[model samples]
Target: MNRPVRTGTDPDEARARILEVAEQHFRRIGYHKTPVADIASELGMSPANVYRFFPSRDAINESICGRVLNEVAEIALAIACTNAPAVEKLDQLLTALHQHNKMTLVKEKHMHDLIAAATQENWSIIKAHTERTVTIFEAIIRAGIEAGEFEVEDAAEAARAVRSAFMQFFHPVLIEHCVQHSEDIEADLRDQIRFILKALRKRGSLEHHRQDQDSQPIHG
Candidate 1:
């Protein structure tokens, strides 16, 4: 006997389609406004079927916002790979981080919904992002210490201090700050970077400060 071909779709592919539709809906209508039915309708699938893939509208929302977070991670990864001078890298990182956090994640609809989304589910994707950022800061701190550029006692502690400059990179805190002062987001981000850098330079030498003008790695 000959066997017939299967016509049914894969569960994973169907799930991805549902999430894709939900993401667009969320961006256009905000999380509260976009219901499960709306996502099902947009995906041309039954609401129950969509539910089968994602347990609820909230789950779908997490996947949606998580996708955006992944995009931000992609940008950070690309920047982290560049071997530019630490000062130039620092400048590039701050500018990119501020604009991405402010423009892509915060300003987009889901706003607070996105923060809630992050809390509701696994955040392995964003975890990878923070790790990457920390690695970059650690490398710079060690480089500075070796080059006699910075006089820090511990590179690991200094790296953590530098990482603190990016509180906005974490979703929940970012949303809360944005909600309180959406108007002054840029100022807040810049001030945060400035404060962290100042703290990082704790007892560091002045001869080789981290400056784009110098174009030199701060080596001990």
Candidate 2:
């Protein structure tokens, strides 16, 4: 049964309501199966009224996907702003990103389908998400440079490199592939993070990392 129209709302609130209901229907029934008319009916409004807020169903899908992708972006931004060391912050950021993708794609295949469709459709969401991620990576790299932890002539370029190097670990489709292939994902992910940190560190910092590794006795 549809809920009563949320009374006394402005345009922004109405749009939000449509999105909220639309997301529910999409999550429950699949994005392609859900119609704007169904979303409108849920909100006790007509499809025409819904179109007044969003131009079309594709617009709504894009908005929903963007909102979902922004969760990772928000987490990365928060980590970038933290008082942690750049290396540690980067590690945490990467781990969080991987886990978030796994949780969404591997564990929650429904959401994965939504994201995959958005990506295949070439929505602006992917470009916007990539820009946000690169910005966060650049912030961390700049911090490492300031802290004398990293040696890089250009933070933006280094950030791009880092993103490229870790793409396999963070990309949703790639992560799904690893799962399906039964790859040694944990060991590979650790190796990737180790390599990224080693590449980003100054000569002295790299030496220190090597020494730290050597100092730890091997465990059988």
Candidate 3:
């Protein structure tokens, strides 16, 4: 006789299994359509049992979304940990992030939809991811400043500005809009990066220009 399957009594294992099944369902049939019952059924458990692990479907979505964001964060962390100069690291990091996101949209349409929805809803996971990414940017900026590549007074503020300026390339909704409109996203991203680099370098020049003006005798 075949042995009966068990859902297992370990809470952590149960939660992990739930997330794995839910992610599979989300990728296959889309998260919006994959009810909690379906996930429980797939695990040979009752919906109420699934609820014991995750309070609600949204909570499950948040966990899955967090997992996806963690992948992107890992990419950023890898680029940051490289020995390249700060300027080059920042450029490569931004390009890699953009390419990864665009690839996801093209190759993982269902997963992309889930992320887009999470972004639109302003999920806490999204905010946490953004903060983590900004922290990475801030570290890069600080390194660049130390290396005399960037001349910003506040690395944190500059990092936030960089994130804001690059939102078009990073934000899922904006990226999708660009694709739908057939915009030259690659060209635009390059232009934007160049513009940001220029801004970082120009701050020092502007400061010197003001000092030069201050040193000159004022005409009475």
Candidate 4:
């Protein structure tokens, strides 16, 4: 039932074809069930040739995972570079991240096991992705501070805090758990963002500050 492998492309295209077929098998059956031979067979090539491009099955997985995470990074970077205020940008970034995780882990689940393995194995790709995310957060926080929109003295620390605070909404494992448990994720996410904005905003700028002052009784 399998088609014969055709050879005419250069090395670059050949490697790319291997990755494409491997991803197809990964999505169809799963990472573990799909072997290098299956991917090679799908491409009408030998498993040895697949290794010519990738050293091992795990290497192929890491490459694919990196590609997926890189997509999110690119999206976040574009949002961070926008003219929107830091508050609005942060909200969009977090919302986008949650949506991405929901689509990947909850809806499609094509790469869930690979992500889990990356987590347990402490893959370099995962570490790089986390660092890149933190760096993007830092950039947005720095912009807010420079624009006098946030009161934080240390942008890097604030960025780290934001990432840690929103881990529940952004982290893949937590996202999966919350989805499976039917948690009110959106409500909680909104509340958390509100809290983050309140903490970041320069005091006295919020309308409620003046309202509270007007409501207070005169003191002797």
Clashes within 3 Å, all models in order: 6, 0, 0, 0
Ranking by TM-score: 2, 3, 4, 1
Candidate-wise lDDT, in order: 0.61, 0.81, 0.83, 0.78
Model 1 segments more than 4 A misplaced: 1-7, 105-107, 116-136, 139-155, 165-192, 201-220
TM-scores, each model vs. reference: 0.68, 0.89, 0.87, 0.87
* TM-score for predicted model 4 compared with the true structure: 0.87
Q: What is the lDDT for 168 in model 1? A: 61
Please give the ranking of all candidate structures by lDDT, highest first, separated by commas.
3, 2, 4, 1
- TM-score of structure candidate 1: 0.68
| Best candidate according to TM-score | 2
lDDT of 3 by residue, 78-114 (tens): 9999998787788778888888888889889888888
Name the best candidate (by lDDT): 3
lDDT of 2: 0.81
Tens digit per residue, CA lDDT, model 4, 1-220: 4554445557777777777777777887888888888888878778887887788888899988887788889889989989998867886788788777777886558787777678778999999998899999889888888887788998889889988888877777777777778567676666676677778878866455435434544221
Q: Per-residue error at 211 for model 4, in Å?
A: 14
lDDT of 2 by residue, 82-125 (tens): 99888878977887788788778756676778887776677799
Which residue pairs collide, candidate 1? 146-219, 146-220, 147-219, 147-220, 148-219, 148-220
Overlapping backbone residue pairs in candidate 4 total 0
Over 4 Å off in model 4, which ranges? 1-9, 206-220
